[model samples]
Target: MSTSTAGRPYALIAEFETPASTLHAAELIRDAGYKRWDVHTPFPIHGLDGAMGLRNSKVGWFTFLGGTTGFSLGMLMIWWMGKVDYAIPVGGKPLFSPIFAFPVSYELTILLGAFGTLFGMFFLNRLPRHYHPLLKHPRFRNVTHDRIYVVIECADPKFSDAETRKLLEHAGGRHIEIVED
Candidate 1:
């Protein structure tokens, strides 16, 4: 609830001693109708996603679309080069044969699909983020160790300093901090 000199809150970070406590806190936050919140732990906790009301990721759709585009483009290029534009008649063979184009088309599909998966994950997850408000909190450094933390952004419509602290305490959080930007 504390604010910086400009009267804008950076973030609220609550520390928990164990994963169980953190998970419980996440459930409480979710039920409390807070949207801009996240939990941090040294390791992934089972059922955390469901407790946080997270939906399935959309990265797979990107991969599928990329592969489809690559396949279609490869087939079109082969047809254009071999049958339509050049119209090379080699040994009286068919101009556009599936057997001849399958290898290159398959390779392109796999290559593009792999690229799509990598880029989609990075884009969707907002990777390469060098800074975050929570990173300024002293205790947040323990996230890579044995500590668990939950952070609620001030951007949430229902956020209030007193109510957030009470919610964290009710969910078994301690050493709560009001981090600044």
Candidate 2:
């Protein structure tokens, strides 16, 4: 395994030939007390998230909060404009009508909810990442074609170069590379 001049590892990446092998490797890694690990595959593999011990995403909460905020603001705007700010009496109608405010509130809710979902995904996923350590590996180039990769970062407390390589090999991984930072 390669290491930096300061004796710090960069990352350990393992290559698998099939999605099933990758899934098995992820499960092994998850159970091995390593926290900083990730899997990459050409296509989505069933049960991979569970194997990786990942929980549901938080983007839905962001969307719900944003929609609620938009709804509240829309209602406040309509009520204030119609009743307190400029109570323009139009054809003997009620100043603060729920029927009239419903459309604006609904539209604003949808708009803000969509924006929240989009931005939430971007933020949660750490988008706009210009470079990644895996991107520098030559075998990683086949990830988009028909390869699966499981990478364990050196930052994990349980990360030991010898043990990690052995674990990956036991989990049916091949072409293991000690990626450099």
Candidate 3:
């Protein structure tokens, strides 16, 4: 609402009346070979990721690595503690049997996998962000309510003010505006 163009340009955003239109715009942006873009909706939209041409997240890899490390560490710790450091054999059972270590290793795998998921999410999302240019946009708050938005950052290599606006307009976007930082 301040209509002041004095601030540095950050992004170009457009409002869509419905999720379907928003999805269409996202597809157009994606096919245009633009990176550094995002869509905002009041709630999750099915197939939006595919529309935006996104690949699967890498968080699962982190979880697998963490779980593997945890299991290996748990098994090694149990084996070293029982078999080498202080051998404790009872009832003719082996000192470092995997059967005995299975429970703790499984628990450790679960614990560390959970941790990996948490940390991976934080890392991928760039969490703890206190500010963004969009956060200051007057229209952006509507995305938390009934509105949907598609934003293309100025930093995107394919971004051009006129052509991007044309694409959004052709894709049924309305009230297209430049967001500033």
* lDDT of all predictions: 0.86, 0.87, 0.88
Off by over 4 Å in 2: 1-8
The C-alpha RMSD of each candidate to the native structure, in angstroms, is 3.2, 3.3, 3.8
TM-score of each: 0.86, 0.89, 0.89
What TM-score does prediction 1 earn? 0.86
| Cα displacement (Å) at residue 167, model 2 | 0.8
- For residues 146-173, what per-residue lDDT tens digits would candidate 3 score against the true structure? 9998899888999999999999899999
Q: Could you give me the TM-score of model 2 versus the true structure?
A: 0.89
Itemize residue pairs with steric clashes in candidate 3: none
The number of the candidate with the highest lDDT is 3
**How high a TM-score does candidate 3 get?**
0.89
Count of clashes, each model: 0, 0, 0
List the candidates ranked by lDDT, beginning with the highest.
3, 2, 1
Q: What is the lDDT of candidate 2?
A: 0.87
Candidate 1 pairs with clashing backbones = none
Of the two candidates 1 and 3, the one with more favorable lDDT, higher being better, is 3
